[model samples]
Target: MADASLFEVDTDELRRVGNTMVGIGDDVAEVARTAPMDGRGEWGHQGLAGAGDRFGARYRYLIEQLAEDVDRGGVSLRGSANAYEEMDAINAASIAGLGMDW
Candidate 1:
């Protein structure tokens, strides 16, 4: 048995969660890309035009940043999963070379 104090990992779960995060990021990015940036004529008040533009720009920046952050998180998760799996394989190989039977 592994040491109780050591951390355990489920690589498949990590990959699954990573995929979900990537999909969510893609969805968020699509919305951010498609959303209208200019609300100049949409609002009845002329004073709202400037505010709308400013808000739109800020919203776009925030949404895009969120998408990028989420995407990077997913990538990081996948990388960790891959690293764990690779390490497991290497360990297995080393054990086999030692002719140790469990």
Candidate 2:
């Protein structure tokens, strides 16, 4: 159902929304990857953006929230950076693959 919506929305708009979401996610991932354990939450763009259309505006929050939880002792950071990087790479590719003219 969700994937269907992603493919069905107005392409230009969805591309814009998706690209922005991915950018935010990427930025959070980079910051979280290098951030000190305590400073990880500073990169809160994703969580802060989690109120709107989730997949549209709140998509990045999933990544941000994870970083926050990890910093709060909810998860280990040993391989966190790799995970975040993978997420960014995957999302960026998805956005670019759309070949949005905008």
Candidate 3:
């Protein structure tokens, strides 16, 4: 089997990536909320205008969903990093209680 020791967690990188994800999500949400839907009025035909409105509404909905998903992922990533740190601390305390030294 490959050495498990080769696997390592880069908590700082995880946090940075999480922050970036959150920022991107916020930006996307802002754009989705502010984007003009009035362009549908410019369509020449009534059918085209209605289709455009439907498409625009669906696009906004999808964007909102994406923003929510990304925000949740960012929170999970950051929380995972913190959990890792807490686990390490508990492990250290256990080792000390057992009179072990690293």
Whole-model lDDT per candidate: 0.79, 0.46, 0.77
In model 1, the worst 10-residue window by lDDT is: 1-10
Query: Could you tell me the lDDT of residue 38 within candidate 3?
Result: 79
Q: Please give, for residues 28-66, the per-residue lDDT of candidate 2 as tens digits.
A: 666645423333335477564443334432445566776
lDDT tens per residue, model 3, 1-102: 011112257777778889999998898898789655677777789998988788788989999999999998998888877877666667668877999852
Once model 2 is optimally superposed onto the true structure by TM-score, how far is the C-alpha of residue 94 displaced, in angstroms? 29
Instruction: Give candidate 1's error at residue 46 in angstroms.
Output: 4.5
What TM-score does candidate 2 get on C-alpha atoms?
Answer: 0.28
TM-scores for every predicted model:
0.78, 0.28, 0.83
- Which has the better TM-score: candidate 1, or candidate 3? 3
- Best-fitting candidate, scored by TM-score: 3
Instruction: Give one clash count per candidate, in the order shown.
Output: 0, 1, 0
Q: Which has the greatest lDDT?
A: 1
Greater-TM-score candidate between 2 and 3: 3
Off by over 4 Å in 3: 1-7
Model 1, 1-102: lDDT tens per residue? 122112367877888899999999999998788656555778788778877878878888899999999999999998988887777667767777999642
